[model samples]
Target: MTHSERWCWYSLLLMLIWLPIPLGSHRMWSWSIFEIWISCQTLLLSASLWHQFPWQKIRKFVWLLAPLSLFQCWIAIQAIPLPVEVLSIIAPDVAQVYRQVGADVGSLSYDRYATLTGLMKGIAYTLFAFNAVVLIHSVKRVKTVLYALVISGTFQSFYGVLTVLLNSHQSWFFGLPQGHRATGTFLYFNHFANYLVMCLCLGIGLIVSQLHQTESGSWHVRIRRWFSAVMSAKMMIRLCLIVMVIALIMTRSRMGNAVFFSVIACGGVIALCFYKRRPRALTALIISMMIIDTFLVGTLFGIDKVKQRIEATSIETETRDQAVQWSLDIIRDYPLTGTGLGSFYSTFPHYTHYNIGYYNYAHNDYVQFAAEAGIPAVVLLSLPILVALWFCFNVIRTRHSKTLKGTALGCLMGILAMMAQISVDFHLQAPANAVTFILILVLSGCVRQIQVRPESHPVAVDHLLLKN
Candidate 1:
């Protein structure tokens, strides 16, 4: 990597590390700072590498990114003031509000300031993902990113676990009493669990990259390979995975825990059934993850609490379900053009019938996005994930490089987990989780675009090449 590229890479690592520190950067001020930081990084990197920009690679994902671009444009449109006639034609409710207040002009957005802030943050996230793709031009860089995520997750896991063990109720930075829940630095347990799920996926992918092919060999050869693994650096990642899993269980988040285990099971099944040359080591890794992480470590770390939460959850008891109903009302009223991006808080109250508490977010990302940006915007947001999922699936089915396949599997599982979890929670609303989700999406789509070199053994490829 060039000096500038190296700095850019470090900048991404710094961003990843800093994101979850300040309540998942969900606060306006925290997110704004990172937005400026990432935008500056993008500008500087583009200035330094404009001549050698990877246009060819970026072009490959044009179809995937086109909708996102349009969605951003849509957000901008929501924030832009339009003539009264134009506003009336597009979003009559917004225009009606203006007229009732004796104003002739207004934006589609009910809260223009919130929409603009959302737009700025959205742009920063887009550029960060773009910069990540541009900088990660090699398998070595991919591993570096994965390791950085694992390390960050491990730190969060350790901190959260330690806080609970110390009987501390307050977060070190946010001063929120977590009440035995391991939220780390994040304000919400669900978002922290979601973040860990993504990190675990990447860490598990790293382990898969380290898996030796299950060829017919003598017992001595198998034993030697197994012993080498026991002594290898993979143990650190394995330990990290364990720590994160423990923290995940401590969160007692029903969907978060469910999605993590579900992804592992589904990913394993897919690999066994679909991978072109599935390795036995891969099967072993998956089995170990399910058996050790879920049964053993989980047993010791409040898995029962998560199960209790799941079993005890009911529609009547849960107010979020009611909130979703009200959110659906908003979506129903504004199907074509939503109330506006970041307008859920402002728009939800008028439709809310019952006491669902003072909910700023709809608690369901799908519902919230639909309520804020309309059904079409929801489609635009989901399109890239669907496209990226296909890319990762193909990588698993067709690629020979273990690192590529592992990364693909990680991206695949992470994306699926996020998709599943977002059904009832707004984890993606947290900027940290959102950016991490985007990075995984980028990795899934871009992994296939990068080429690989010939290697004697697929298992040894990443390690040897990275070392060299």
Candidate 2:
């Protein structure tokens, strides 16, 4: 970490911490600032790392970004003005609207301004991921960023808990009263829960990265190892994880909680079935998280509320199902080119059911994305996540470094969790959550680029083995 590189990464860290603070950065002003800040960071980082750009390692990841780049290009095309005749051939509906107003020019997008803003956000997120990959080049730096994420999450958890404990009716930075739901700095409970879930995954991975693969040595040695773990920095991280879990439960987000526990179960199964030498520490950590977090901490918090919400969920009770059904009409109408990025709100009104109220999002990310950007765009956006998941699996299956493997496992679970949650709610609509989700996916693909070398410290070397 040279001085310039240090400046780049630290600035990025500050951005990540700042993102969720201003109502998840969903407000136009906040996200505008976010884009400007990341753009500057990208420029600074690019200039500093121009001498050694790690082109060899970056080339391996280019294919993973192809679909994303195409998606952005597609959005840009939608925002561009075109003659009405060209628009009619591509998007008849858009052309019909222009013809109704006796206009000779139009674009595929129903709302070009919204589409352009969406394009800017898309580029910002892409640049942010690039900065992360290029700046976090080593295992130590990776650990540092992960720790910072956990620390930021812990602060959110603590603040959310404190607000609930005070029995405050008013939400933070908003007039709506959240009651018992813990929303942290975010206005929405589910978004906050989703953010915490990602942080918890990273914290758990950091712990796994530090754990010895297989327990060995005499009774005294094993006991010492256990004691050291209980009294180490990992213990503090564990505490943070617990706080986050408590906050998650307090949020009372049905799908958010369900996706998290389900992903944890899936991760444990994959590890046991695939890893040749299953680390005792890995199993213990999983068991503790499942039991301690869900049972003990949850019992103390409001896990029952979360369970009740899940049990009470049904098509009849939820309006989002209706929204999703109506959104399909938009997809049907614009199957080829879509209404355009960020055009869902405007386009959905035409198909909205009588029972459905005004909704900015379809509440299902997949449906909203398809409705807004067309089916092809949905596939394009999904490609990077699917490829990143493959990368995570490869790292976990083949990498000798426990740290890398653990990080991969965490990223895999986090991505899966987000995917599951997005099927029911548009967590990705929030800029902060979207950015964090992209970071997790980017980090997963970056595991191969991490240089794993033996350290002088016996414990450090024991935890992160030399790469084969």
Give the per-residue lDDT digits (tens) of candidate 2, residues 115-190.
Answer: 9999999988888877877777788777887898898899999989989999988765666676788999897899
Local lDDT at 415 for model 1: 91
Could you list the CA RMSD of all candidates, in the order they appear?
A: 3.0, 3.3
- Look at candidate 1 and give me any clashing residue pairs: none
Backbone clashes under 3 angstroms, per model = 0, 0
Model 1 regions lying over 4 Å from their true place: 458-468
* lDDT of model 1 at position 464: 52
Q: What clash pairs does model 2 have?
A: none
Q: Per-residue alpha-carbon lDDT of model 1 for 378-411, expressed as tens digits? A: 9888888888999999999998888889899999
Q: Which stretches of candidate 2 lie over 4 Å from their true place?
A: 171-176, 454-468
lDDT of each: 0.86, 0.84
TM-score of each: 0.95, 0.95
